[model samples]
Target chain A: MDLLAGIFTDYTLRNVALGAALLGLVGGVLGSFATLRRQSLLGDVLAHAALPGICLAFLLTGTKAPLILLLGAGLAGWLASLLMLAILRSTRLPEDSTLGVILSGFFGFGIGLLTFIQHSGDSDQAGLDKFIFGQAATVVGEDVLTMAVLGGVALLLVGLLYKEFKLLTFDPAFASSLGLPVRGLGTLLTSLTVIAVMIGLQTVGVVLMAAMLIAPAAAARQWTNRLSTMVWLSAAFGVLSGVLGAVISATRENLPTGPLVVLTASLITLFSLLLAPERGLVWDWRRTRNNRRRIRLERLLLDAHVLYNHAELTPESLAQRRRAAPARAKEELEELAARGWVTGRGERWELTEQGHAEAHRLEQAMRVLPKALNPRAEGGAGGAA
Target chain B: MSSDFVIVLTAIFVSTASALLGSFLVLRRMALMADAISHAVLPGIVLAFWVSGGERATAPALLGAAAAGLLTVTLVEWLTRTGRIKNDAAIGLVFPALFSLGVLAVSLYFRNVHLDLDAVLYGEIAYAPFNTLEAFGLNLGPESLWIMGGLTLVNLLFVLLFYKELKLSTFDAGLAAALGFLPAVLHYALMSLVSLTAVGAFQSVGAILIVAFLIIPPATAYLLTQRLPVMIALAVLVGAVSSVLGYVLAILLDASIAGMMATVAGLLFGLAWLFSPVGGVLTARNRRERQRREFAARLLLAHLAHHDRPVPAREVLEEFGWSPAFLAQAQQWAQREGLLAGDPNGLRLTARGAALAGERP
Candidate 1:
């Protein structure tokens, strides 16, 4: 309870939560475009390649200011993306391989440079290594301010060009024919992604920042089909997960904030995958079951109609015709009778006029289904099946 | 042997083993999976050690790591099979969770142990020479050398014995299955081989940049060559050179050997990307230019063959709207080939040029 109270009133906790939330919002908005384009791993590549930039920033500036470091990291990440695009255009190697090579190559160089700095006897190069997995607990007021200002600008850009980006994501060739600079817009979008990743690097680190960028967007994808809804939902989910992760970590003695936030986002993804209304697994399973029942009921009605048109039909004969058990046939007859489609079900069953009409429609549908399926069997031979 | 010799030899073996396994992985388009498997094997190593009553160096840990590799592949395949996520996203999801689990375990349960995270990231190859192998009371250089040598041998044998199967499965799994060959088996075997190599190389290159040795050398070779055998050979050569050069650079700068090696590998890949002779960017453009010039020359010769009247060179350029450079190069090439003779203001096709233009493929 005190933790909850601290979340509302505590200065440090509030700042950390706000910073995390700001990053989450922008990451979520950008990740929708990324996930839709099947370029989710671009986040991972950019984050890993930013390590060298961070080290370079500190080495040159001799200061560990968050904004300066992020500027360096963002520029490095942008350069990596450009190099990646060049390799793809120039070579036949797939994007995945190019991403892996740049990620490790740049990161390895960063580590080498960092080790040199450590050995150079600079005492203040202490917390620079935390970019590996992030340490969100170390976030301060100035850091939050930096994140909000940068992230706000990015979000505003996304809002201003939402329709253009939407067209760009769905169809690039069409956008190009309409006189849009497809490649330039693509580079701009990539630059925005780099900025968003840079904003979250200090709090989430390199390894898990990829998760933050992807998981929220992926989770929101399950509940939506429209691009606008997806972007907003993703941003909402990202903020909630970030703030909750921060507050929860604050409760523990020494739990890592970054991974915990990622874990929370991941849990949200798992739930959305299984529980969302339209695309969720639970909904799909229920839909399939209902469809099965409807199909079986129609089959029983058609079989009963063919057995003995206007006369009463015995359940045993109906079962024989259906190749099903007698008890199962009797229950199906009872269900039809209960629904007023048939009447007087027992050892014998009689079809109502509605039931007879339904059976005829189903019989006609079954006859046309084969002809529709086999286009070669068009014309008067539709009933041959 | 001197310690420096042992260090370089160990590095060579490590690079060769990884580069060989990585060749198949890269060709199969599973380069990032090596990175995932490398990270995912951490918990497997830790569990194997903890389960075997604190036995530091043994076979169970290796077995556990191999199991982890197979498990990583299985889980990734399973996740992708669910049809909810993509292959890269599935890879992104699985590795970090497992790697983070491994990290949390180290911090929670094994804090008192010597499994430092730094060693996991940047391996201390400097101490590898000190851990000498002992057999029959005679020292056998670094233990890493023997392990990596055996690994390279195993990989070589696997490639030699199953060369046909690997090739067929990699190129066309459906056809392999139609011919009663099990592509899945070869895939699992390759995964196990990659896992074992990754575990063995960990002491030399650490977990992070194993992807570098696994990818960069083979990728560079891929850019330079088209044949698989030659590609593999070139990858091994690249790896060896990168190892030797990186060792020298690292010794000079007193930096991590693995990092320097990775940087060197990246540099080599960059060079191959820019300057490979076979269909590389630089060469491909040049080839296109040459083909265009030859084609223009043929067109000019054919044009001359159609007319007995003297035609001004200026007319050809104005008629075709060809670039001045292209027209001049075409005329010069035709003249040199004896296809066309240039007069003061016009060109004419010779008898040979007429005969050549008369023939059609």
Candidate 2:
């Protein structure tokens, strides 16, 4: 309870939580577009590419201020994006290979710069490596303010150009036909993504920031298909993971906030993937099972109706007709009897008047459902065996 | 041997080994899969380190890392099979979570272990020489050099033995499967080799440099060559060159050798991107210009022949949507070749130009 109170009373804890929330907000908002566009790894590339910029910024300014370092990181990330685009257009290398090249090349150059700085005997390089494995504990009120401003700008731009981005994401060729500046919108969106990545760099670190951008959005995607709802839900999941993870790490002695937050988001992603209502794996499995059961019930009902005139309806005969076990047929009969579609005593059974009606309806439905479902109705001989 | 020689040799072996598989990776467009495996194998390495009680059990470590790599591939495939996410997003999701788990494990539990996070990303290749491999109380030079050299030899054999299957499946998996080659088995085999190489190289060159050596050299060679064998050969050559150059540059600059190696590899790729004779950026532009001139020349000739009269240059420009300058260039080329004899504003097709147009028209 004191840890809970610490969140509200302690300045450092409040700042860390706020910083995480800010990173979550911008990352989730922009990440929806990234996942939708199938450029999910772009965040990874931008984050890795920002390292050189951070080192260069420190080299030039001789300070480790959050705003200056982040600005430099953002510019370097932006430059990397531009270079990526140029390479994509001018070369035949596939996008994955190109992204791999930019990510590692820029990171290696940054590492070289970092080691150079370290060998140069600079004592102030201490805090700069924190950007790698982000020390959220070091986040102060000023850093929170920087995150808020940067994240706010990115969010505002997303709000203003929401429709254009939506159109661009779904159908850029159609957008071009509509006389939209598709390329300009795309570049702007990519730049916004760069901003989002930059904001998360100080909070989640370089290697794990990709999770912040991807996991929340991917988790939210399992919940909804609508763009607007996806963006909001994604942002909410991000915030939830961010705050929860920050609070947990704050209370714990040895936990790192960045990986903790990522792990939390991943758990949420796993949960959503398995248990969401429509698209979740569990739900899908249940749906398939239910569908199969329904089909079996319908087939059993039709079989009983077909055999009613020829032979006395018995569990033995029904089992033979369904190629199912006698025990299973008896169980299905009990279910149908409970539904008032069958009347039975001992081993014998007969269809009720309601059962006859349902069977007839099922027959007609089977014959016509295919025509209803298939517009072309190529093979019109639809009937139950 | 001097530490400098050991370091350079280690870099060369690691680079060559990675570049060999990197050729197939680039062709398969699974370059980032190497990145994923490199990061995801951390926990496996860590666990193996703990379970084996030391780092001396390299086999267990490699096995654990390979298993982890395969698990990563499986999880990604499972996620993509769910149809909720794409292959790329699935990849993005699975690796970081596993990597985070690995990082948290390293930081929380394995403090005394030699596996620090910095070494995970920026491997101490410069210090690799000091960790000498001793077999039967005899000094056997750097362990990294031996491990990487063995990895390079194993990759070379894998490629040579499976050359036919790899080539067929890479270019046309459908046909390879139709021919009963079982492309799926080949794919897993390739991924396993990649994982083994990644784990072997991870301790020396680090993760990002592994990506660089795996991707940039093969990618650069790809821009220069069209055949698989040539691409592989060229990639190894480029990797070797980059290692040597990167070592010298790192020494001169007093920087991270691995980082300088990747930077040098990037420089080579940049040069190849700009200057390769096959589909180089500048060559593509020149080819586009020449093709445009030839095409415009044909269109004009065909138009003149069809009309059977000299058409106004302005009319030709308007009809074909060509800019005035482009039209002038095409007309001047045609006239200089004696394919057309006309004033500045008129265009007439000569016999040879008409024959050229008729041959294609």
Candidate 3:
């Protein structure tokens, strides 16, 4: 308890929490559009692209002003995005390929520039290295305020253009037909995406910023179909992950904040992908199992119905009639009896009236299947199954 | 003049190499994979340095980079095959983790070593001239020329030898599979070549210039042509041009030659984006202008068709609120294009014009 108190009281921890919260808010809001546009990978590319810009800014100004560096980062990121767009539009290169090219190239350039700066013996370059992977612990109060203002503006813009964004994402042709300035909206969305990336770049660094943008929104999408709800839920999930990650990182002596936050975000995404109510893997498995049980029950009832038509339906005859293994048949019969779908009379199993009706309906449904399945059988019993 | 000539020659050599390789990459839709492979090979360089006890040994670095590049592709492929994660997510997860691991390794394990992360990240292209090689009787710059030349030859051979198979595989992998061509084998082979080329380029221009070379040239070429052969040739030309320009720019700025080269590639892409004939910004603007003209002509025709009696041209212009020159131009074009005819009183459609109007309505 005392250790926890001591950790919480630290200024660095407070700043880390503040920075992460701001990043979460901004990333969540921007990520919604990125996911919708299928440009989630753009965040990843842009993050790496910012490195050169940051290095270049420091080289030019010889100042460590966060604002200047961020501005430079934003410009570089935007330039990379533009280059990516150019590659996609002009060349036969695929979108993913262009994204990969710009990301690596810009990052490599940044590294080269950074190396040059280091070799040049700039004394002020000490802490700037941390920007590559990020140092959330170093975030200041002023940075938090800037994030809040930018995040608030981004959210407000999204709100104002919610309907337009929706229409544009789902049906671009329809939106263009309505004369909604599709090009302008696309540019706006791209700008917002860059801002979101830039905001998080300082807290999480370029390496994990893309994860922060994609993971929470992807997880939240699994829980809801409605756009607004998904956005809000994603924001909540992002905040929760960020706060939790900061706390966890604070608990450790040397663990960085970015990786922890990303791990938490990844965990949330995994959970949503595996365990969400409607679309999750678990739900799919359960549905398949239920469907198999229904099919099996229907099959059992049909077999029992056929047996009932046979003359002298004794236990021995019934045992012969059941085509499956005796142990399997016995288990299924027991289940049917438990469900009141079948009853034992004089050591012979017979379907109840309800079971008979269900079996008849199922047979009728199956009659459609053979015709649907075997289109060559026009009027034969093979067509009717 | 000598410096300029050398810069130009180097640019031509590098661009040619890059373009030759880029054609395969763009077609495979693995253009960005080049970038990923380039970055992921950092650990390979570091490992090579560690094994050799220094950066002097070229073989170790090449081996390490190739291994790392292949590993990245394998990891991405594995993650995607699981069906548990999206392709983009797999990429996001794999590259960063590997890159971070490399960074961490450099910082933690190699702190005491003479080499730094910057050396691995940026590369030393300015020192390329110092590493001399003897080929035949002449002394040539070490590795850069040989590596690029060899990769270019391999790329050309691969493309020529398996053109039909590559085309089939790239366009329709499923069809290629149905036809008994193993796309997986082809994919891996292409990735290996890309990895090799990327590693080679890393020494001359660093990773970023390699990316610029891979993407920018092909992109510019794509803007200029639709045919694959033409596009490939054009891309090579563009790449070569940018390399030369970049080198000159670097000399002028007294900056990193690789950085300047990448900047030049970017500039070329920018020029293509704005001014390319087919689908550039300027072309789009031109298309918009043509569309507006068509719209105005249609509106005028509709107005003339709607009238019960002959209307004067002046009244038509006033109703549409368009300039007289625009109205006159629209009328002239409509008439010349056979979408309209002039009666004694006013304009009417010819049989062809009526058919066109009727078809639209």
Candidate 4:
């Protein structure tokens, strides 16, 4: 209750929360596009690449302005994204290696620049280092306003150009054939992605920004298959986690805001992976178990019915009818009797009226009802749509 | 040895060793594993320092790093094998958590210690020379130099001894396993080696920059060569060259040697990315342009061949969206090849050019 009260009443807390919420919403929307493109690692690349840009910005301006640093970061992040894209298009190197190279290499240079700048004694205080792992306590009204404006623009761009962006992601070749400037639109999207990453730089830093860009979108994926729905859900998840992380971090003295935000997003992903109604681990496991049990019970009913028809109705025949395990069959028979699908105790099992219908359903399943009867057999692994 | 020379040589040694391991990694398409190991080794370093009670021995640190590296691989493998998340997603998941733990350790406990966050992220290569190892009351130069040198020697020997096993497993794990080579075990061994190398370089290049040493040189060598042996040798050369060049550049700019080395390495990669004759972008682009021009010239001749009379070059240029310069160039090329006879009024294909155009179908 106090945390909630702090969120509403405390001005600083409110600004931090609002900034993080905007960060999540814009980041989630843009991250959804990157995730769908299978360029999840691109976020990591941009965030790392942005470091050198921030250093360069500081070197040029000699000030600690958030907007100035972010502008530098945005451009740097854009450059890295462009370089990766260019490398991918031109070089024979695989995507993973290309991504790895650009990320580490750019980041190494960034680190070099940072250390050099610090050593040169231009600023005894390494104010830019705070952007590494962002501190929420420092975000003020101006930063919040800037974040809102930038995030709002990013979200609006995604909405306004949704069709073009969607086509570009799904089928760039087709989109180009339709006379869309696929390359230009792609560059535009890349810019928005960097902007989203830059906004989170002072909040989550670079490493965790990579996580926020994908985790929320990834979690939203488990809940829905539609891209539009995924975008909305992803945004919501991002906002919730960002605000929640900010609020929770406020209750503590020494917690870094960005990592906690990432942890929160990661927790959301974990929950979504485990608990979402559709395409979740729990849902798939429950469905698989129920289907297996249903198949087992129905098969048992058919065996008993067949044995009774053949006038082999004793417990020995019942045991004979149950091939794999007598104990499993006996237990299943008890379950069947309880459900009124079978009758006759003392190790003798007879089919009830419901049992006859259920047996017919299983028999039908053996031929033409695979889809309706068992969904697990349809999708090969993990129940992914 | 002079400290400058020692620093440069140490950088070269560490880089070459990383490049050697990185070649196999790049081939196996696990190049990003270098990045993962670099970040994941942080907690191990901290824990080793804390648990081993600040020992001077490198064993505890290496043990912690190996454990951490192996754990990262195992965790990623387990996650992937579970078929739940993607390989990239698992990587994205594991590194941050471990890295953040390291970050938290830095912020909380190690804040008061000499093991600051800067040292963890970017090692003090400049200070490496001042920290000497003494044995039997004899000065042993820089400790990082000795440690990194020893680690490099071990890496070289390991690569030499297991060359065949490493080659087989890296290229075709299935075949190697079928032959009872135990590729999985070999994989972990290689990962552990990579971990140890990262840890060794960590104090000099910090941890993340170790990835630049591991991946950049090998990737550059990959662009230049195909054979594994040549690739390894070239990677060493590349690393040594980049390290020296980076040192000189750092001296001139008065910048961090490690960062400059990484920057130089990145520059070298950019050069290879653009100019490597085998698969260089410029080479491919040149090849494409040559093909496009040749095809256009042939088509131009073919069009002329369809006309029995001399056709006005301007008319042809107008019919196609061909620039006059391109048409003139094409006409000049045909004339130079004795495939066309042209005046200012009109151009005509010679019999050879006619036959060539006719034969194209």
Candidate 5:
């Protein structure tokens, strides 16, 4: 308890926690759209694409202000997206390939610029390196305020455009038919994603922001069917993971905040994949096991009913005729007796009044031959022999 | 000028490799795999650096990047085959995890090391002149050029050797499977080539430029042509041109050469997207205009046919509110197409014209 108290009191811990929470809120809300559109990988591409923008911004203005860098990042990120779209539309190349090309190319350029900036030896470039892997500890009060405003704006935008986003995501053709201006709506959504990724860039950095965007929404998908519920749940999971990761990272020195946050989100996704009620592995396993058990019981009952068709056969004779193990045959007979479908006197067992009705029902259910178990026919055959 | 020539040559070599591989990637719809491979290979690079103990080492780094690239493809394939997750989700899950691992490895092992993430993301293409290789008594400064050249040759050979197989498999993978050819093997081979190209290109242009090279040129080529062979050829040309122009632009502005190159590639795609004669922005707009004109002409022709009168041109103009010039142009087109006949009295549909209108209805 004391150790926990000591860990929580640190200024770095507070800042990281606040920053991650904000990033989580934004990522979760935006990621729902990405997942729905089946463009989840776009998040990864955009995150990497932001690097060149940051490098360029710093190189041009020689300013390390977060706002300036972010604006530059946003512009570059947007351009990358445009290029991706252009490639897909103009070429016979698939959308994924186009995306791949833009993502790597832009990111590579960013890295080159960043390396140049580093080698130039500018003192003001102090915290600029943090954007690569992210340093939650570096989040100042002003940065937190910025995150809040940006996160709040993102949520508000999503709320305002919720209906259009849904229509556009589910069926663009239908949305267009309804005169909803699908292209405009698509641009709006992409813009929102870009903003969300940019906001996350401060805490998770470019390397791991995509994971934060995708993992929480993926995790939330397992828990619910409704879009609204999924969105809210994803938001909650994102915030929870972010806070948890921050706290974990705070407990130690030298642990990068981005990986911790990603790890936490990944854990939530892993949990959802394994344990969500309707679609989880455990539930599926239980369902299959129960189905197999039911099939086995039904098969045993059909066999027992066939035996009962022979006139008052002794338990021993019935077991021997079926070539059944005595103990196993006795268990089946006991189960039938417990259900009042059979009665026993000493070692002999026979179908009772209710038992006979059930036995006939079993025959009808199994569609087996009724005369196959007739003792009189068997006796006549034996006498002829 | 010599530097510009080299840059252009480099672009041609890289684009040739990227375009050849990109054709299959586009057909398979695994274009994002190339992106994933590029990012996920960082660890391999870091590992290569770590194994060689510095950035000066090239062979180990290349080997490491290749290994990482292969691992990424294998992992993605495994996750998809497990049926536990969707393909996009699988890609989303794998690359970041690996990337994060790479980042973490770099930070943990090389805390005091001079290397930074910037170097990993952006390579020093301007400084690429410093690195040279001697092959069979020939001096090739900028070893990346040779590496990319070798990979391009290998890619060309592979594609030529398996052209028929690749075409059949890409167009109809199920049929290919039924015919006893291994589509999965072809897919893996394509992925391997993408990885090799990405890693080879990464040194000179950095990761982002490599990506731009892989996607933009092919996309531009795709807009201009429908045939795969033609697309590949055109894409290579576009890539080479962009690289040359971008290098010049970079020199003029003193900007990052790779970034400028990517920008040029983007510009090319944008232009192609708008101006390509085959289903581009202009084409689509023209198609719409043509349809509107056809509709207006058909409406006028139908009105005349229904009335069985010498309909006044003024009356048709009043009903449609179209420009006189447009109406005249439409009439001329209709007449040329044999959809209408005109005498001094008025315009009427021929039997053929009536049949054409009726068929649409």
Candidate 6:
């Protein structure tokens, strides 16, 4: 409750939270397209590549103005993306390697410029290093307002071109066949993503900013298959992590806001991977286990029905026919008995009406849907029995 | 030794060590693993220093880095094996998280220590001459030089000894495994060396420069060569050259040495991307253009050969629906090649063109 009050009453906290929220909102919405396009690593390249641009913007403008700096960042990121795509199209280098080259190359150039600026003794560059790892605590009303305007534009464009972006992401060749401006839409999408990265630089910085664009969207992917739901959920996850991370960092003296936000987003991704309803790893394991058990129970029922038809329903005899110990057979009988599928005492047993009907149903199911009914391919043995 | 000489030597040693192992990485299409490992090794370095009671010990640091590298590979592999995420996304996810944790650890716990964040990103390559190693009361040169030199030797020996195994497993893991070579074990061994190299270079050239040294050289060599041996040798050469040039440029411009090294390496890659005769962008484009023109000439000659009499250029356009510009280019090419002899008013296939067109069917 106190934290809640601080969010509204505390000026610095308010700005940090607002800035982080804008980053998350924009990153998540555009990141959905990035992730779906299988270009998750592109975000990292673009963010790293934006550094030199930011430094150049500072050097040229001689000011730390947020809007101008981001413009520089956006332009550099845009150029880097164009170069990456061109190299990918024209060269034999793999995507990852091409991205690595641009990522480290541009970043190296940026670092060189940063060191040069420092050596020049420019007092205006006091907080420039903050852009490297980001200093969320330094965010003020102006930075937040700039982030809001840029993020709002990106979000509005994504909303307007929703259908075209979807078609482009899922099947570019098909979209091209439909006479859509496939290449234009793709370039526009990347440009919007560049805008997203630009807004995020002041909050998450370059190194961890890719996670802001990837983790939320990746987590949302586990929950839904539809692009619209995924985008909305991704944005929500991004905002939650961003706001929570900013508030926590503001509360803690040493914790940095960007990393804290990334850690929170990563935690969400890990949680979704393990616990989401349909696609979660945990649920997948459960479904497979239950399936095995169902198959076992059905096979046991069919085996018992066969033995009963042969007038040999004793535990010892049933055990011999099923190649199991008499003790194991007795255990199996008790389980069926608990379910009221069989009636048994000591050594002899008989199938109940429900058991008989179930066995017949299984027999019919196997005949009609052989593959689905018999995953283990033990149908021949069951039929012979 | 002059500090400039030591710095350049340290850069060269770091580059050589990274480029050797990075060749195999690029071949295996695991180039980004270099980036991932370099970033992920930060926490290991921090933990090593922390556990050593604030002393910088080489053994603990290397061990920690190797463990961290292995952990990164295992996590990425495990994530991919879950079938929930792709290898690239797993890498994109794991390294940043580890890196963030490392950054947070530094700010939170080691704020008062000498291991500041800036040093981690831009290691004191400029100050390498002062950080010397002493043994048996004898003064050794810069410690980073020794570290990087030793790492380069280890990588060189590893690549030499396991040349066959590395080659087999890298190109065709299935075939290598079928022959009981245990490619998986070899892969881990290679990743461990890459980790150790990154950590060793981490203190001298910083993280991002290490990535440049690892990827750019080998990638440049890849664009220029197909033979693995030639590729490895060329990568080391490029790395060495980049380091020297980058150091000189850094001195002239008064910029960060390691950053300039990376910048030079990038410049070399750009050169290779544009001009390498093997699979270069311009060369491929030229080849494609030549093929298109040659085929158009052949088609034009065949069309002329179809007629016993001279066919007017207008008749040719009406029948084949050729763009006027394209047809003119093709006709000019044919006439130059002696495959056709005609003007726009009249066109006929030469004897050479008739023979060439006869071979088409």
Kindly provide the TM-score of model 2 when superposed on the true structure, using C-alpha atoms: 0.82
Q: Could you tell me how far off, in angstroms, the CA of residue B184 lies in candidate 6 after the best superposition?
A: 1.2
Residue-level lDDT tens digits of model 3 in B144-234? 5666677778888887888888888988999999999998898898888777777776655566667778777886676667778888898
lDDT tens readout by residue for model 4, B132-156: 3232111333777787898899889
lDDT of each: 0.81, 0.86, 0.72, 0.81, 0.76, 0.87
lDDT of model 5, residue B188: 81
Candidate 2 residue lDDT tens string, A1-385 = 8876888999988888888888888889999999999999999999999999999999999999889999999999999999999999988899999999999889999988888888889999886777887888899988888889888998999999999999999999999999999999999998998888888887889989899989999999999989999999999999988888889898666678898889999999999999988889998898899999888788878888887758978888888988989898888788888879899877889999999999999989888877778856555444321
Clashing pairs in 4: none
- In model 4 chain A, where is the ten-residue run with the lowest total lDDT? A320-329
TM-score of candidate 6 on Cα atoms, chains taken together: 0.82
Tens digits of per-residue lDDT for model 6, A229-269: 99999999999999999888977787899999999999999
Scored by lDDT, the top model is: 6
lDDT of 3: 0.72
Best by DockQ: 2
| Number of clashes found in candidate 5 | 15
Work out how many backbone clashes candidate 2 has. Answer: 0
Among all windows of 10 consecutive residues in model 2 chain B, the one with the lowest summed lDDT is: B129-138
Q: Interface Cα RMSD for all candidates?
A: 1.5, 0.8, 3.9, 1.7, 3.2, 1.0
TM accuracy, model 4: 0.78
Q: Write the per-residue lDDT of candidate 5 for residues A1-385, one digit (tens) a residue.
A: 5434643676667777888988888899889779878888888888878888988898899888888888888888888888778656645656676676566567646654664565567777777767877877788777877778877887898999898898888889999999998988887788778888778888988878888888899889888888899899999999998888888776666677788888788878878877898877668778899999767655555566667675545566656756888776787778777778778865777777887676567667755454566667767888999
* Candidate 4: segments with Cα more than 4 A from true spot: A173-178, A282-385, B53-57, B113-115, B125-141, B285-361
Q: CA lDDT of B104 in candidate 1?
A: 59
Compute DockQ for each candidate against the true complex: 0.43, 0.66, 0.18, 0.44, 0.27, 0.62
The positional error of residue B75 in candidate 4, measured at the CA in angstroms, is 2.5
Please list all clashing residue pairs in model 2, or write none if there are none. none
Q: Which stretches of candidate 5 lie over 4 Å from their true place?
A: A1-8, A45-94, A97-137, A157-189, A251-254, A282-385, B1-8, B48-63, B78-84, B113-115, B125-142, B286-320, B324-361
Clashes of each: 0, 0, 2, 0, 15, 0
Better of 4 and 5 by TM-score: 4
Query: For residues A56-146, could you state the per-residue lDDT of candidate 3 as single tens digits?
Result: 8998898988888887888999888876776567555467756755775577467646655765677888776667677787888787777
